[model samples]
Target: MLTMPDVRAPRLLCVEVHEGRPLSFLTETAAAHLAALAARSVFVPTTTRTRKQYRRIHLPGPPAPYAICANGGHLLVDGESDRDWQGAVARRLAEQCAPLAEVLAHLERTAHPDWTRKLRTAEELFAYVVTERALVPELWLKELSDWAGQRGWSLSAQGSKVYLVPRPLTKSAAVAEVVRRAGTEVVLTAGDSLLDADLLLAGDHGWRPGHGELADQGWTAPQVTALGERGVLAGELILAELLRRV
Candidate 1:
């Protein structure tokens, strides 16, 4: 197992797990090894999808000690919110920018129904239908960006949904808070989307499966390893990196 020189006693780690996307070992032996490595760890799953939407996915047995839900809105323990932790986030997002209602209004107005599907918004993540990525007028997206910018928010095109999120609302920010509470000494993280980039970069070392948005864009950073793997490999990739740190 790898170790940072300044510390002893198996380092604590914070890991963000992306839902539905599999990392190779996560469903198999690799996850067990990862569990053995850290002093403690938290599974942070960031998704624009809500908690109920996430629940459909089968997380491996003996569930992670902690889990992040609602794209970082709900920090769950035994599948329930750790209110104190999640409340801090809601308070911050509330204070920081326009509400989800306003963002959804803009999305509905800007998005053409034919190209959009599954228009939904959670307390933490707000998104709407977008299809024919190349076909979507540049001006529309730009206008959306401008709209978000005015509200101190951001827009990202991930898969079908055009995400309108608060600039201050980030999976990384919420994950960091949980890490602090866990008193983790080192963090090992992974993900498969543009949204996961922040958490991955913040880790001591991060892995990106070749199939993901970031890797598809290309991995130029020394901090990120393009695993040339996807699905379960995406989950396994992160476990593999954490194994070395263990």
Candidate 2:
């Protein structure tokens, strides 16, 4: 497995599977910086992970007032999805892009047993499939991306999963709402995936790790800083940069 260097820095436990069972770790430097940033800024978590998965990782700070989950298919406030926002997102997805059922049908038609493990619909807004990354066919992913684009959807092949998400169902939309609610003018974000493009773009400032879908595509924007470190170290670098900038 590819792993980043465990640099000699004070470390903070970020995720744990069970009592005394560590799952993820971050540098204490990054943790303290993030905690200070949270105290002064509107700190919101934006991710492609489902709410359940997002909840598993703990950060050093007060609870975020808002979280964008399921690749922006759902917005969580105080750990729960805001029903009104969810309804609005569903309506927009229905009105603006191919239905979830249609996308699922397309996936079914193009299914390849060599890579696919399981297909799942999330929040009835987007779909993704667990795949053997080494077995994934590049041409197949390209085809899916082209097809989804034609239908106002997008395909993101990241890690062990391939996500098919509607164009309107975006993290930016939910984050914008959070900004409005908080009345904050400054927004900063850090992410490493193609699914995070919108969220990163929408923010006043953002950072992307030197790995994941965005880095693989060589994506960049004027306000976004691209770091060279990859893997877990890339994550730490992002937090460090976030602290430095804000």
Candidate 3:
């Protein structure tokens, strides 16, 4: 839990829109905890965000040595994507899942423009559709999920975005690479979405907020602690707990 719930909050703005408007903020306490955690450990920001999108957030801490972006399709080392890693991921996706073009064409044929706001391809690895959550039919979503599943892809709807990602493109895979390079045995992680489920499971210890797709599904595991806090408060608690453990 590392961000403020209210955009209007006076907390330290950590993420911003392309136009420079505040998108996410971190409380001073959370910021301090994150900074401390970074000082002691290899703090990696693992996310489903594309490399460009991940760069928008200025998290409070020394810059992380590695970041897993595009759901592990790209690994950033010192703010630049590792080309060798990208090539490996590309090969994996080519072997494991249906091509991105096929998925994109299916969406174009099936998705209704009335509900779909935009269809985007991230890192040319996966596709997502921005939709009005309420307007999206459950049956359509289920069907889409089934279709993706059959093709070695998975669908997750978080907030207003529905992601159709290749099953092999996972954050945990990239994190393992980082761990190997860092030569660390103990791994800790935190996340609050379906995309993050694998990462949480891979960690020796992990945490999830009371909100997001995983929380909504009541997902949990023995090594993962499920917190009751929501929003940015949850982010603060996660960082605090991580700081304590490290």
Clashes of each: 12, 0, 4
Across 1-246, the per-residue lDDT of candidate 3 in tens digits comes to: 434446655465455566757777777778889899999999999999988888998887799999999999989999999999999999999999999999999999999999999999998999999999899999999999999999999999999999999999999999999999999989999998899999999999999999999999999999999998888788888999999998
TM-score per model over all chains:
0.76, 0.90, 0.95
Q: In order, what lDDT does every prediction score?
A: 0.66, 0.82, 0.91
Model 1 lowest lDDT segment of ten: 8-17
Choose the strongest candidate by TM-score. 3
TM-score, predicted candidate 3 vs. hidden true structure: 0.95
Best by lDDT: 3
In the range 15-132, model 2's lDDT, one tens digit per residue, is 5464557777766666777788778777787887788778888888999888889877788888889999878987898788888899999888787877789989876778999999
Predicted candidate 3, C-alpha RMSD:
2.4
lDDT of 1 by residue, 20-74 (tens): 4532224445546555553344555556557776665554435665677666777
